[model samples]
Target: METAVASAASTGRAQTSRSRCRMSPKRYEAKLRLAEAFVRLVEAMPAERITVNMIAEASGKHRKTFYYHFADKEQLVVWLFRYDLASGLADKFPEDLLVREQDSPDNPLAEFPFYARRIEESGRIYNAPFFAALSYSLEKRRAYYRRIFSTRGPGTLDFYLHQLFFPAIKEDILFLIDREIGRQSAVERKALRERMTSNAGVDFLAEFYTGAFLSRFVERLNYTSARRTARDIIPFENVVHDSLAALIRQEIEKAAREPGSEDRPGKGGAPCASPA
Candidate 1:
């Protein structure tokens, strides 16, 4: 009788273990479906418009299941940004022009091809929900700058702010170029080059080039309520890029000229003690 009782207990334990193992895959699959559904919903509508019911329906899961996997839609959105968007952009350094070799001379112009390629690739991936998720993440973080630097001291604040801002500006410029100019062939490239140089000054030329690229990119997105026109987006993107680049360059030059002028001190004429 004791043997039979032990056998039954073992059987029950084995069954419970198997059941837990089976549930793990199902749970994982459900979470993946929910994330995918969230992406689709955000693409169709803005982040604010997405509801729990909508996500549940889209994922083909019960409302309770969403709660089991995620606390709320906000948590899910945060997860998507932290995991999905970050994963996509992390290793994809635009190699063609953006990041030059350490030995290479400083050449901002070298980055143009990288920007063009990025825009082209962005257009190709425009249909993917990942791009929309990334865009949403960027939009959400726009206020992060103000929040992070608002209380910083002036000396540290200006330097920190530039470090924070320039990368975003550069990325935006690359997005514009990749979307618009990368796809153009030899002839089309020449025509676009001619058009850019026609009446625009040197400063305006960069803006025009970046603007044209971005406008084409936005047009390709076919966003339902896109605020800027194709013609306008490139120039606006360029202006932002140019302004940020100029500001950063100016700051770096000022630091080079007056290493210890500020509260900080360093050799190699670095503004701060450590190298950037």
Candidate 2:
């Protein structure tokens, strides 16, 4: 009896491990499709106005399928933004950035084999996880990030951030911000221990810009949704980018002039601190 129980327990653990494996190609494609669909829906309507049923319809997937992948709509928002920051969307696609750029696109080659991109050339992005990630074909690549850059409509980071402040997803945004700040604090603490140049200013700068952009964005959304006379909030995007960059440069220099901030950096690498 004891021997039989041990064998069963070992078999169950093996099955559990296999079930948790995220390396499957199927899961990757499915998740990408769902994410793409969510981007489309949120672009046309505020995130708070979207529903699981709507997302399912947009994705052409069954309602139950969504639950199998995520607990709720809020999970999808968090997952998308987390993926955005992690995948270097904020860095690679900064044309839509509301304030300033701080990061860059992650290199897919770092994880995949050298031939991984070649495998993607089978003329179908969905052929492999690597192609969806590493393909240079902009049209084909749209499956992953085509919608991320429009400040006006689709994949606009402004829309993404603007919707977060709405009541519908307030808790979700709070959870994400808390987690991000926690991660930043951990990184800063780790850098302090190692005596390295810490990116301590990143979190503060991100907070400053996010707060600034959202305040204006909230007014835009409110005015539009109410059918009021609309003035474009960010008519000239390059101008906004340049203006914000200059403002930060001014402020950082001003801060450094303060008595205790002599050691603080007056400017960062790149106009936005990409470090290269």
Candidate 3:
């Protein structure tokens, strides 16, 4: 759900089990300790200033131990996202990082491509415990946002988050597509990777999704009526589910239809058209 963290982590690879999706209970706890310590440090110091030693000291673990759990601080932060979001779910969530779910409490992150896949594959994961877990996890993230981005903008917070989640959703869609098509051949996979990395067929679709969900998240976050909580997101559960499934399906179809380059990376920071 952390935008910066997600972009950094999206090397276009799925997280291996040893990281968190599948880890010994003890290992999960150890990593969680580091994650919590990092969050705690953020409460006092900027994330940029915090170092491995500081995080290790806070977790009461040695420095080398951090490397065992994570390849680098960025990777650790990636798990921090999963750890914080999933812990509240109490093992009811999937093995990877909980995404888009962060914004609307019911939203998706690559969170959705995989999330939509799961909901269709299994009915058990759609139970109340799942939402309950989200309630706790998202609130935790909200508090973190409040403190960390105090000066950023309550007004534009939704927009900023929308921007972040869109990429995750977009990349996740690509990741899913890669699973289906990229593995067919090494060359095809490279082309797929290069293709998806650019903002082609799926950019606007991701934008629509992130906007819809994140706006709802912002509204609930600042509702100012009967303090917002996880339950607030329950009514929208089915809407979110159907929306994600549809969005992903549409995107993949579009990509399949147009297998040529649509846009490149260096747009020279072209500005969006100004409002009239």
lDDT of each structure?
0.38, 0.37, 0.49
Better of 2 and 3 by TM-score: 3
* Model 2 alpha-carbon miss at residue 80, Å: 7.2
Candidate 3 residue-wise lDDT, 49-100, digit = tens: 8899999999999999998877666556545555554445435655443433
TM-scores of all candidate predictions against the true structure: 0.31, 0.30, 0.48
Best by TM-score: 3
Order of the predicted models by lDDT, top scorer first: 3, 1, 2
**Displacement of the residue 153 alpha carbon in candidate 1, Å:** 24
Off by over 4 Å in 2: 1-64, 77-202, 225-236, 251-276
List of clashing residue pairs for candidate 2: none
Q: For residue 33, give model 3's deviation from the true position in Å.
A: 2.2
**Model 2 TM-score, 2 decimals:** 0.30
* CA error at residue 156 for candidate 1, angstroms: 28
Task: Please give the ranking of all candidate structures by TM-score, highest first, separated by commas.
Answer: 3, 1, 2
Which ten contiguous residues of candidate 2 have the minimum total lDDT? 12-21
Off by over 4 Å in 3: 1-24, 86-90, 93-135, 148-202, 214-226, 241-276
